[model samples]
Target: MNIKEASSRLGISARAIRFYEEKGLIQPAKQSSNGYRTYTENDIWRLQTIAALREIGMSLQDITHALAEIDQGNQQGLEEYLELQQAVMYAQWVELKRMMDTTQRMMDLNRQDGSLDVSHLHELAGSARRLREARQNWHDRWNYDQQAAIHDQRVQAGKTKEDKPFSLYHNYDEALEQTVQWISPVSGEAGLDIGTGTGNLAGRMLNQSAVMTGMDQSREMLRTCRRKYPQMHVKLGNFLALPFADHSFDFVVSSFAFHHLGPEQQQLALEEIQRVLKASGTSRICLTDLMFTDSAHRDAYSRYAATTGDAEQQRALRERHFPLLGELCNWLGYLGYETKHIRHNELLHTVLAVPRP
Candidate 1:
């Protein structure tokens, strides 16, 4: 069968089939005179098996290794891999349940006076911070001091029109332009950029004469941001516990950073963003990481990750808990925000949200 036929029969896309081939996961039996690849029944079965493994949350690397073992007739290794995956999935389920319980507790604290108990909210925030700190490994993954030293070089390389290291790093100028356009920073308005790595987003807002303050967990990154933009304020902070008062900014923005956080942390970060924004204020944000819209999409991302050779990045990808777009939208609605998905791509998402009156 041709690629299209295989795709149709398996309920997968032609692009996905090509992706598997690119990863060396499948090989067609022949190439026709027209230069089309042809697959055999065995190939189709192999593809179907791969899709099934992916649906079960197996990473591409894991799937590849398991398949190789299976081809060699080693069923024991496959069983071991499945056991490990089951443990990981169970842990994630527990964490999710904890987050849900926390949310419910917070909701229960709302008084009959239509006001939230400030002290109770603070306690919940502290719980969230603790949960995130326990699960997060970014401090170990990123060497902020080293990254800061080469920050300008990396940014310049990313801006070049030639081959780039990663899609997120490609076309730096274009990405920044799109972020600024989506944010639409107003002159003299106060804005905050969370996880402001090297102040890229903050700098764009500052160019519009907006009062921009940047926050990041890495002190070294904040130092770089300060040296580059002396006029803007840079703070050493994390998303779970923002170092600012309530309703402090007219707008808030973040770019390519939230994926470092766990699902619970993402929710806590959004709450903090909303807290720091003035009533009816907007937040235009971009997330450049894997987003799992469904099981199939999650599997597709795992395959994409297999193509990358960066071990640290691959580990981060494995550890990261991507929040589903629908779940995020629901969270926004529950928090009294009107949310709009500005752009949804395979590995990126842009959203514009405003507090509802």
Candidate 2:
């Protein structure tokens, strides 16, 4: 349809549509005969998404970013964008409510006394602004972004007394090699490594001639990964929601990053792994991280931690989401995949999955 038709269909003015195009929000094809712009159904839907986001107070820049994320294979991009906007609106609500409460308190003061004190009102408003500003900023508990630079260095710092946090990283190098070996990379095959911090696991497969794509949640880690393997593909994504199309890779692997997710996210991540792998029977999923042999193993570890009175170890044990080996296998089985557990050590292990017959 022509610009007029699109504007009519969208119930938006042609000028507004032109303005959106000027902001690089949409690109309509030009008719070959008259060079007139034409909009397709996809373009119209894109425009609708933009309009909806703008209605909710998203800046043009924010809308552009959300659209780009969707282009990059985040199928849940709209939901994620809405969640971010919700956070922003919630912050704005706090600021507005704080100001409103201060106004009410000032009104209360006037009701109790003959007149309002301008200086006292100013102080209350200032305090409210400061508190609202402080409450608006959110920080990650792990601080992975800040730690990206030294992530490779601190993996097996070996500074622990006996039991320590992230003991899975203790055999980091060996684990990476074993994971790569387990993958048995074949030339010309497409492979993806999730939570591929600093390209540790992905880089090991360079000589195997397989096309490797590394994905991580931390941008700084991706920067380092790019520096380490310039030819390898690197993407910014998390486990629970992958930024790739369905059935996109021949095999999928991950290293040392899955434990960061909670139980539900872990299960969701498993489904995502299954979704992204190709339909061929030989397609596989391999993962390496800290895991218990089973429920009994987890109980023994908890009991050992308590008996030792090592406060730090106990805290680490409490904080980490170490999966049970049996649970992982069962989840894979339920997902139509056969799973094999490989224990590298008492605390470190790997799990490989292939589609069941």
Candidate 3:
């Protein structure tokens, strides 16, 4: 096969194949009579292997070393090389997850009250440094320490009646009420609240005599929750890996928190929520975040932020990850959830879904 044929058969770009050949990771089998470089079956296999390694996050240098070992028939050396690369990739994943969380927190702070505070910027920098120093492994995408501190501050502010969290949304209370109605928890029915900041929604469910177990990644937030609702069960855990047995809850819900996850992590978290939910159980997610269907919508938001004269809002609008409502519904459906309704406004969205029968 010529380069074009091999590229098509291997599902890689021709330029990528040429670059790999340049790096000595692959080579053409021979030069045809017409002076065209041709690849044999073995060459295609080698290119496929190189592509596979790259997909698994291997660097070019590491892949070259592994390929060299394979050529030398050093099976054990290749295994050791791959194992080392796996460890390095895992460390990088942890750092990237921490950085993602820090960036999300910064965006959230920027969105608050339509202005950025200098002290908040300093706090964000400190949080980034702490995340780097801690180097801890986490199942979810959020940095718990920073999130917990922010939640604690919000809780304190709520107590003082100064700045209520989620107050910016005109329909915040209505959305919460709608989610509760959709879940329709009966007395003694077990419910799980993922990312239950300060146990607000869980407390509301508790009012209906439902058994509420709230989970959050932040210990400080859980502390505040425990103090607020002495009888409610609050645990420190991540949405990606719910620390619960399968089929544990009759219903699951989250409020204004799911958007903290990236698109991939959001799907994983939904899967985890499904795993914990009992058959026929419902999930209501009240999301007070921005969602843009395309770049044009994003540009319009930018203009709106500038017109409003909120520098912080403009930054938040630029940095936040706003998934499309249609895409979110598709993810839920693909995960075997029967999506019931997706209600939205300029600044908020609510998704109601149930486990497929």
Tens digits of per-residue lDDT, candidate 3, 1-357, equal: 889999899999999998998988877866657778889998999999999999988999989899989999988568656655654564565456657978888888888986678798788889677545433333444455566656645444433323322223445566678778787788998988888878878998999999999877665677678789988987666666576767788888887677666666666667667767776635443333446655676678667767776554665555445666678778888977666554555656667776677
Q: Which segments of candidate 3 are over 4 A away from where they belong?
A: 1-169, 281-290, 293-296, 342-344
Query: What is the TM-score of each predicted model, taking all chains together?
Result: 0.58, 0.62, 0.53
Each prediction's total of clashing residue pairs, residues at least 3 apart in sequence or on different chains, is: 0, 0, 0
Between prediction 2 and prediction 3, which has the larger TM-score? 2
The local distance difference test score of each candidate is: 0.72, 0.79, 0.71
Candidate 3 weakest lDDT stretch, 10 residues? 159-168
Error of 1 at 235 (Å): 1.0
How does residue 336 of candidate 3 score in lDDT?
75
Residue-by-residue lDDT tens digits, candidate 1, 1-357: 888998999999999999999999998866656788998999999999899989989899989988998898887567546654554564465456567878887877874466676888899979866875655543426566678778768767654435433344544565566667767878888888887878888998899999999977665787788788989987666666566766788888777677777777687678767767777535444333335665677777777778867564477567666667777777888888777664434545566666665
Candidate 2 lDDT over 186-274, as tens digits, reads: 99899999988888788887768889999876667877888899999877666655667778999999887777766665776787788
